[model samples]
Target chain A: MATLNLSAVTKSFGATTVLHGIDLNVADGEMIVIVGASGCGKSTLLRIVAGLETPTTGHVAIGGREVTRLEPADRDIAMVFQNYALYPHMTVAQNMAYGLKIRGTPKEEIARRVDETAGLLGIGPLLGRKPRELSGGQRQRVAMGRAIIREPKLFLFDEPLSNLDAKLRVQMRGEIRRLQQRLGVTSLYVTHDQVEAMTLGDRLVVMHRGRAAQVASPMEVWARPADTYVAGFIGSPAMNLLAGTLAEDGAAVQLRAGPLLRFTDGPRAGGEGRPLTIGIRPEHMLRDGDAIVTVALDLVEPLGSETVLHGTLASGEVLTARLPGMVPAVGSNMPLAIPAEALHVFDAETGRRLDA
Target chain B: MQDAVLARQAMARQRRGRWLAHAALALGVLIFAFPIWITLVGSTHDAATIGRGDVPLLPGGHGLENFSTALGEGGGRMHTTPAAGMLLNSAIMALLIAGGKIAISLLSAYAVVFFRFPLRMAAFWTIFITLMLPVEVRIIPTYQVIVNLDLFNSFTGLTLPLIASATATLLFRQFFLTIPDEYVEAAQLDGAGPLRFFRDILLPLSVTNIAAMGVILFIYGWNQYLWPLLIINDRSMETIVVGLAKMIGSGDTQNEWNTIMATAVLAMTPPVLVVVLLQRWFIKGLTETEK
Candidate 1:
C-alpha cells in the first residue's frame, strides 16, 4: 500500500495549459476517481502519475519516494489503458507473465503467479487463447490480470469500463472495487461518467476546465459542491440553477421570473439586492412543499421508477424536476414546491458557493 | 404468371453474361500462359529441331536427354559448371539477400521509428534516397568497391549491394507507425526495455510484413541479371539466371537452344514456387496486420 502525494502539479501543451496546478494527497489504499469532461486533464494527471507524461511543474511522490523522473517501470506502478492494450500476439497467460519475465523472475514463479492471477480473474480456461479469441469482457479481465500480476504499489485505470456494455460495466465496476479492497492497493481511476465516479471512488476529484473543482468524498461533493460547475456536474438531470436577487432582509431570494423563496437555513453572507444563483437538485422538487415556484410543463419523461418533468419559466429559462410519478399535463403553469432548507446559494459573478 | 416470365428472362440474361465472362477469362489466361507454354514445349525438343526456327508445340522424344544435360552436364557445349550448381548458387543468393534485407531493415526501421537520436530524419531520407539508384545505375562504382574489397566473385558481392532495400525499410517504418502508442506504454510498464520489447512483441507481430517482404525480395534477388554477370566472371560462381542468359549469348545459331530453354525453366521454377507457397501469408500480411 502507498500514500500518493502530488504537489501543485501543472501541465501545459506549449501555451495552452491542460492541467492547472493540482494538489492532492491520496491516503493509503484509498481509491480516488478523477471525474471530468473530455479535455479536463484527468487522463493527463493519471498519465503523469504513471510516468507516461511529465508535468510541466510539480512533484509526484509515491509511498514517501519522489518518482517524478523515474520511468514507468521504475515507478513501481501498473496502469490499465482505455483500449485494454494487451499484446494481441501473446496468449492471456503470456500477457500476464510478461512483466515478471522481463524482470528475470524464475520460470516456475512466473507460471505460478500467472496461473493464480488467471484464476483470480476467472480466466484460467483462457490461458492458451489469444486476445483476439476472447470476448471484450474477457480481454478487459486479461488487461486487469496483467496489471494485477505485477502487484505494484499503485493501480491506474483509464476509463477501463467504457468499452464494456452497461450491465458488464456495472459488474466490472463492483469487481474492481472489491479487488482493490482485497488487494488494498492505492488506485487512481479516471472516467467521464459521473455514476462511475460516485459508485467507485472513495473520494472524487471533480475537474473543470483544467482545475480540480472539488476534491472530497462522493456524498460531500454531492451535497456541497464548491462551484457552479461542480454543482451541476455531479448530479443526475443536473441541479437546477436559477438567477435571482437577494431580498432586502436577506432571508429570501427574489427570482427574475417572479417568485420569493425563503432560505429556511438562515441568511447567507451577501449584500441585500445583490444578484445570486440559487441551486436545487431535480429530485428535491416536491409536489407540495415549503417553497414553491410556477413552471409551465413542456414534457414528461417516465423513467420507470421516476418521472422527470421538463418545463420553462416565465423568463424563458428551462427547468427540470424529478418526482416520484407523472405530473400534470403539458403547457400547464403549475407550482412545484421544494424544501426551503435544501437550496444552495452561490454568488452570481464568481459562481462560487456562498452558503457554507 | 407475369413475374415468372420476368424471372425466366433474367435467368436467361444471367446465363448469357456467365458465358461471356467465362470466354473472356479463358482468353485472358491463354494470353498470359502461351509464353510459359512455349518455354515448356521448347525445353523438350532436340537442339537441331529448335535451331531450325520451328517452335515445338508438343514434347519431343529428346525431353529427358535435354533436361539431364542442362541439369548435370551444363547448358553450354564446353562449360564445366552444371545448371544445377548454378541454380543452387542462385538459391543461396536469393535466400541470403531476402533474409539479410529483412533483418537489417527491421533493425534500422526500429531505430528510426522507436528511438530518438541526432540526424534521424536525415538517416531515414538517406535510406529512402537509395531507391532512386538501383544497382545497375551504380554498377561501375559498386564493382570497383567489390574488386577493392576482394569480394568480386563471392556471394557477398552477389547479394550485399542488392540487399540495401529502401522499399522494405519504408514499408516496415510505415507498418511500425501503425502500432498503437499504447502498446509501447504497456510494454514499458511491463519492464520490457527497448531490445526486449523489440524481440518479444514487435518482432512476432511483424511476422506477416516480414513474410510478405521476404517473397518480394526473394524474387528480386533471384532475378538479378547485370550485377551477378558483372561480378562473377568465373563460370563456377554463376547464378541460374545469369548462366541461362549467357547460354543464349550473341545468336541462336551457336547456342544449345533446348538446353538453354531447360535452364531458363530451372531459373524460373524456384521463385514461382516461393511465391505460390507463401501467397496466403503475403496477402494476409499486406491486408490484416493492423487488425
Candidate 2:
C-alpha cells in the first residue's frame, strides 16, 4: 500500500499546455479518479503518475519516495490500458508471468503465481489460450491479472472498461473496485464516463480545460459543486443553469426566466442587483400548483417509471426536468416550482460559487 | 416463373464462366510444363538420339543410367563440374543468402521503424534507393570490391554481395508499422528491455513474414547465374545454374544432351522441395498479417 503525492504537476506539448499545475494527495489505499471530457487532460495526468509521461514541472512521490523521473518499470507501478494490450502471441498465463520473469523470479514461483492469479481472476481454464481466442471481458480480466501479478505499489487504469460491453463494463467496474480495495494499493483511474468516476473513485478530480476544477467526494461534488462546470458535469441529465441577478440584499435571485426565488440556506455574499447564474438539478423541479415559472413543453420522454421533460422558457432558454411517474402528453405549458434550499448560486461572470 | 428463369440464366452464365476459366488454366499449365516434360523424356533416352534431334516423347530404360552418370561424373566432353558438387554449392549459397538477408533486413527494418535516432529517415531512403540498382547495374563495382577483398571463388563472395535486400527490408518495415503502439508500452511496463522485447515479442510475431520472405529469397538465391558466372572461375565452386549453362557446348553434336537434361532435372529439385514444404506458411504470411 502506498500514498501518492503530486505537487504542482504540469504538462505541455509545445505551446499547448495540457495540464496546468495539478496538486493532489492520495491517501494510502485510496482510489483517486480523474474524470473529464476528452481533451481535458485526465489521461495525461494518469500517465504522469504512471511515469509514462513526465510532467513539465512537478514532483510525484509514491509511498514517500520520489519517482518523478523514473522509468515506468522502476516506479513500481502497473497500468491497464484501454485495449488490454496483452501480447497477442503469448498465452494468458505467459502474459501474467512476464513481469515476474523479467525481474528474474524463479521458474516454479512464476508458475505458482500465474496459477494463483489466474484462479483469482477466474481464468484458470483460459490459461493456455492466446489473447485473440478470449472474449473482450476475458481479455480485460487477463490485463488486470497481469497487473495484479506484479503486486506493485500503485495501479493506473486508463479507461480499462471502455472496450467491454455495457453489462460487462458494470460487472468489471465492481470487480476492479473490490480487487483494488482488497489489495489496498493506492490507485489512480482515468475515465470520461461520469458514472464510472462516481462509482469507482474514493475521491474525484473533475477536470476542466487544463485545470482540476474541483477535488472532493462524489456526493460533495454533486451537492455543492465549486463552479458551474463541476455543478453541470457531475450529475446525470445535467444540473440546470439559469441567468439571474442577486436581489433583495443578498437573500434572493431574480431569474431571467421570471422567477424571484429566495435562498433558504443563507444569504449569498453578492449584494443586490449583482449578476449571477442560478443552478438547479433536473430532478429538483417540483410540479406543485404554486408555480414560480412556466415552461412550454417541446419533448416528453417517458422512461417507464419516470419521465424526463424537455421544455423552453418564455426567454427562449432550454430547460430539462426529471419527474416521477409518466406525463401524459407533450406540447403543453408545464409549471415548475423552484425550491430555495435546492438552488446553487454562482457568479455570472466568473462561474465561481458564491458562499453564504 | 420469371424468378426461376432468371435463376436458370444465372446458372448457365456461371457454367460458361467456369468453362472459360478451366480452359485458360489448362493452357497456362501446358505452356509451362512442355519444356520440362521434354527434358524428362530426353533424360531417359541415349545422348546420340537426343543430339540427332529425335527427342523422345516418353521415358526409356536409360533414365537411371543417365541420372547416375550426370550426378557422379561430369558430362562427357564438357569442362563443367559434377551435378552433385554443383547442387551442393547451390544449396549452400541459397541457404546462406536467404538466412543472411533475413537477419540483416529484420534488424535494419526494426531500427528504421522503432528507434528515433538522427537521420533515420535518410538511412531508410538510402536502403530504398538501392532497389533501383539491380545486380547488372552495380556488378562491376561490386566485383571490384570482392576482388579487393580477395573473396573470389568462395561462398562468402557469392552470398555476401547479394544479402542486403532492400525489398525484404521494406516489406518488414511495412509489417512493423502495422503493430500497435500499445505492444511496446506494455512490454516496457512488463520490465523488458529493448532487445528482450524484440526477441520475446517482435520476433515471434514476425514468424509468418519471415517464412514468406524465406521462400522468395531462397528462390532468388538458387537461380543466381550472372554474379556466380562472373566471379567463380574454379569449377569446384560453381553453382548449379552456372554449371548447367557451361554444360552446353557451342557445337550441339559434341554435347551429352541426355546427361545435361538429367543435371537440369537435379538442379530443379531443391527449390521445388523448399516451395512444397513451406507453401502453406508462405501463402498465409503473404495474405494475412493480423495476429
Candidate 3:
C-alpha cells in the first residue's frame, strides 16, 4: 500500500486551465474521494495521479516516489475506468492475467493470481466468458479483478460505478468499499455523486471549478462547509440561503430578515449592519408558531419516509423544509422555526463562512 | 358466373407473369454461358475444323487427342507447349505480390490510423493520389526503375512494382478506423508495445478486410498482361497471360485451339476459386465502408 501526494499540481489544455494548483496528501491505505460537478476537473486530477495525464506543473508522488513523468504501467498503479475498459476479446481470466502476462510473469503464477482474484470477486464461474457476455455489474467486477491481480501500490477509480443502474450502483458501491477495506489498499476515487463521496470517502475533497473548496471528513464538511458553495453543493435538496443582516440587540445578536422575522443568539461583534447570507439545511428547519419567521407553503413532496415542503419565507426568499412526516397540503401558510444553532452564516458579498 | 370469370382471368395473368420472368432469366443465363460453352466445344475440334464453323456443338470424341497435342504429348514437330511453365510462373508471381501487398498495406494502414507523426497526412494523400494514376500510366518509369535495379525477367521484378496500390491501403485504413480507440488505450495500459499490439489486437480484428484484399490482389497479379509482356521476354519466366498471347501470335500450323482453351481454363481457376471461397468476406468488407 502507498500514500499518494499531489503537490501544487496544475493542468491546462492550451490557455484554458482545467486544474488550478492543487495540494493534497492522502494517508497510506486511506480511501480519499474527490467529488465535484461536471467541468470541475476532478476526473482530470484523478487522471494526473494515475499517470494517464501530465500535470502542467508540480509533482505527483506515490509511495514517496515521484511519478509525474512516468507512464501508467511503469508507475505500478492500476486504474478502474468508468467504462470498465476491459479487453473485449479476452475471456475474464485472460483479462485479469493480461497485466501479469505483460510483465512476463510465469504462466502458473499468472493463472494462480487470476484465479484467486476471480474467486475474491465471485466471478470464478465467469473465467471463460468474454466481456461482451457479462452484464454491467459483472464487467465491473472483472475490471476490479484486473486491477487487483496486479496488486499495485495504489488503486485509482474514476467514477467506476457510474455506469450501473441506480440499484446496481448502490450494490457495487458497497462491494467496492468492502473490497477496498479487505485489501487495505490506498485508493483514490473520483465521483460527482455526493452520496457516493459521503459514504465511500475516509476523507472527502470537495472541488469546485478546478480548485479544492474544502477537504475534510464527510460529516465535518456537512456540518461546517468552508464557503456558501460547499454548503449548497454538499447536501441533498441543498442548503437554504437567504440574504439578511446581523443586528446587535443588547446582549444578543439578531439576524434581521426584512421586517418579518428576527433571529437572535450570540452577541454580535463586527457583524452588525453588514449584509450576510443566512444558510439552513432542509432537515434543520421546523414548523413552530413560537419561532421568528412565517412562511407560505408553495409545494410539498411526500417521499414516504420524509416530506419536503417548498415555500417562501416572509422575506420573499424561497426555502425548503424536510419534516419527519407528511407535510400539510400545498399553499398552506405555516410558521417555521429556525433553531439558532443549525443556522450557517456567510458573508453575502464574498460567500465565505462568517464564523471561519 | 362473373366473379368466377374474373378469378380465372387473374390466375391466367399471374401464370403468364411467372412464365415471362422465367423466360427472361433463362435468356440472361444463356447470354453469359454461351461463350464458355462454345470455347469448350471448340476445344474438342481441330483448328481447321473450328475455323470452318462446322464443328458439332457436342464433343467430337477428340477431346483427349486435342488436349494431348496442346500439352505437347503428341510428339509432333509443329507442336508448342508452355502451359505448365506458364502456370507455375503465374502462381509464383501472384503469391509473392499478394503476400507483399498485404504486409505493406496492413503496416501502413495501422500506422496511419493509430499513431501521430509528422507528414502523416502527406503520406496518406500520396497513397490516395496513386489511386488516380493507373498502373499503365506509370509503367514506363516503373519499368526503367526495375531495369536499373537489375530485376528484369525476375519474379521479384514482376511483383515489386505493384506492391504499393492505393486501393488496398485505403481499404485497410478504413477498416482499421472502425476499431475502438479504447482497445488501443487498454493495450497500452496493459504494457503492450507497438508490435505486440499490432499482432495480438489490430491484426486479429482485421481478418475480414485482409481476406477481401488478398483475393483482389491475387486476381490483379494473376491477370497482369501489359507490364509482364514488356518486362519478361524469357519463355521460362513468362506468366500465363503473356504466354497465351505468345501462343495466339504463332501461325495456324502451331496454333491449336483446343489446347489453348484448356490452358485458359486452367489459368483462370485460382482467381475464380478464391472469389467463390471468400465471397462473404469480400461483400462484407466492401459494404461496411467504415470511417
Instruction: Point out the higher-scoring one by lDDT: 1 or 2.
Output: 2
TM-score of chain B of each: 0.94, 0.94, 0.88
lDDT of each: 0.90, 0.91, 0.83
Cα error, residue A35 of model 2, in Å, equals 0.9
For model 1, the DockQ equals 0.76
lDDT of 2 by residue, A1-356 (tens): 78999999999999999999999999999999999999999999998998878999999999999999999889899999999989999999999999999999999999999999888889999999999999999999999999999989999999999998999999999999999988899899999999999999999999999899999999889999999999989898999999999988998899999978888887888568899999999999988834378889989999988899999998788898999998858989988887888999999999999888
Selected candidate, larger DockQ, 1 vs 3: 1
Query: Candidate 3's residue-wise lDDT over B1-291, tens digit each?
Result: 999999999999999999999999999999998877777777676666765657567766667776666555321233454566777888888888888999998999888888989999999999889888776989889989999999999988888887767888898898888777656766767888889889877776677778888889889889999889988988778788777766674454555566676666667778889899999998876675321
Which stretches in model 2 have alpha-carbon errors above 4 Å?
A289-291, B1-11, B76-79, B251-253
TM-score list, all predictions: 0.96, 0.96, 0.87
State the fnat of model 3. 0.36
- lDDT per residue, candidate 2, B1-291, as tens digits? 999999999999999999999999999999999999998888888887977878688888899998998888865456357889989999999999999999999999999999899999999999999898877789999999999999998889988889965989999999999998888888888989889989999999999999999999999999999999999999899899999888888854488888988998999889999999999999988999756
Q: Is the docking of candidate 2 incorrect, acceptable, medium or high quality?
A: medium
RMSD of 1: 1.8
TM-score of candidate 3's A chain against the true A chain:
0.95
Position A300, candidate 3: lDDT: 89
Can you list each candidate's DockQ?
Answer: 0.76, 0.73, 0.35
| CAPRI tier of model 3 | acceptable
